[model samples]
Target chain A: GAGVSQTPSNKVTEKGKYVELRCDPISGHTALYWYRQSLGQGPEFLIYFQGTGAADDSGLPNDRFFAVRPEGSVSTLKIQRTERGDSAVYLCASSRTSGIPDTQYFGPGTRLTVL
Target chain B: DQQVKQNSPSLSVQEGRISILNCDYTNSMFDYFLWYKKYPAEGPTFLISISSIKDKNEDGRFTVFLNKSAKHLSLHIVPSQPGDSAVYFCAASAQGSGTYKYIFGTGTRLKVLA
Candidate 1:
């Protein structure tokens, strides 16, 4: 309800296809983040958003991955030319501010499977 | 390169006993550390956090300790319960700015037997 919400809890796509995963942050959260988690591993940062702008995207594996937060509240992660290695649980988290570095609330995550 | 590491992959404790999870890092610029707990198919929830300046921080049943000198940290749960059975992750923030990426450890699954 009030927590971060991710759409398309699961996504299955063929290799080299395109996919988009959506994330709806909490009502007032201004900072949103995207992370990818592989099996038995910790989440790795993919992108960070402060409002409508991406503050850092160094964690993005390649040019195939891109994200946008148009209204600053809801964001979408778009993947192009998806590969099997891209399959993982994509997590979205939101916090009060990127500077706060305090608490972060996460969504259930969208499981992406590539064939 | 993995900056944060949780040497132990899993830990088990009897209910009502104390449970301790350990974590270490290779970075010295990290200013803040936090712990999160995750259950099956669910996102991780924030448990506790401690600043590098402070040696400890406590909240209810959870406590976090930071040792900046040793680049080590720990999460302690007193009177552990079955509900505490989950994967615990340790994370760190480096000055918390710009991208504000918080690197995380592999995670340790803590099983509290009832």
Candidate 2:
């Protein structure tokens, strides 16, 4: 498919364990973003990477949540010591650029369930 | 604090009727606003957007109106179709931010009943 793709459409893990979710953006996209959507809420920004560097990560709930886009094409979100609170739909988005009129294309989220 | 808010959790309208979804923001710096539609288990798709400089933008059957003075915006769909039923989200961004980081509203689920 030409749109963003995310691996492991769904994941189940026990609390305190670690998990990794991957995202593959559309070809040539330079900006990638990670967001979490809980029941009855909108997706909240977690981190954003411009190329291989994280341009902003102020939305990360805590230090345990980390993400990286080493090559700027594929990105991974790593969660350590997951809690039930971490259960939500993890969404990934990509855009051609991060400047004005920025429009993001999103991927079908990976539903993370931390029991 | 939630910079953007969608007070209505859900709305139901009959097909061929008009549907209106409203949004409000508390941030004064937001210069651009956008609307997104999401289906179950799928990612949100960009619907339309309007800049603060414009009071209204229209595309096909959809129209978005922005009231910068009131910090409010609305999405209107004429002759709503059942396929248009989904969750709608409102997002905003400031101008100077290089990444144009978006702050999103909780979302309002709209059901276009056939």
Q: Among all windows of ten consecutive residues in candidate 2 chain A, which has the lowest summed lDDT?
A: A97-106
Candidate 1 lDDT, tens digit per residue, A16-111?
999999999999999999999999999999999999999889899999999999988999999999999999999999998876555678899999
Alpha-carbon runs more than 4 Å astray in model 1? B96-99
Score candidate 1 by DockQ: 0.73
- lDDT tens digits, residue span B38-105, model 2: 99999999999998889999999999999998999999999899999999999998855564678899
Model 2: what is its DockQ? Answer: 0.78
Give per-residue CA lDDT, model 2, range A1-115, as digits (tens): 8999999999999999999999999899899999999999999999998999999999999999999999889999999999999999999999998877778889999999999
Model 1 chain A weakest 10-residue run by lDDT: A96-105
- TM-score, per-candidate, Cα-based: 0.97, 0.97
Best by DockQ, which number?
2
What lDDT does candidate 2 reach at residue B74?
Answer: 100
Weakest 10 consecutive residues, lDDT, candidate 2 chain B? B93-102
Residue A114 alpha-carbon offset, candidate 2, angstroms: 0.7
Candidate 1 structure quality by residue, lDDT tens digits, B65-114: 88888899999999899999999999888755443778999999999999
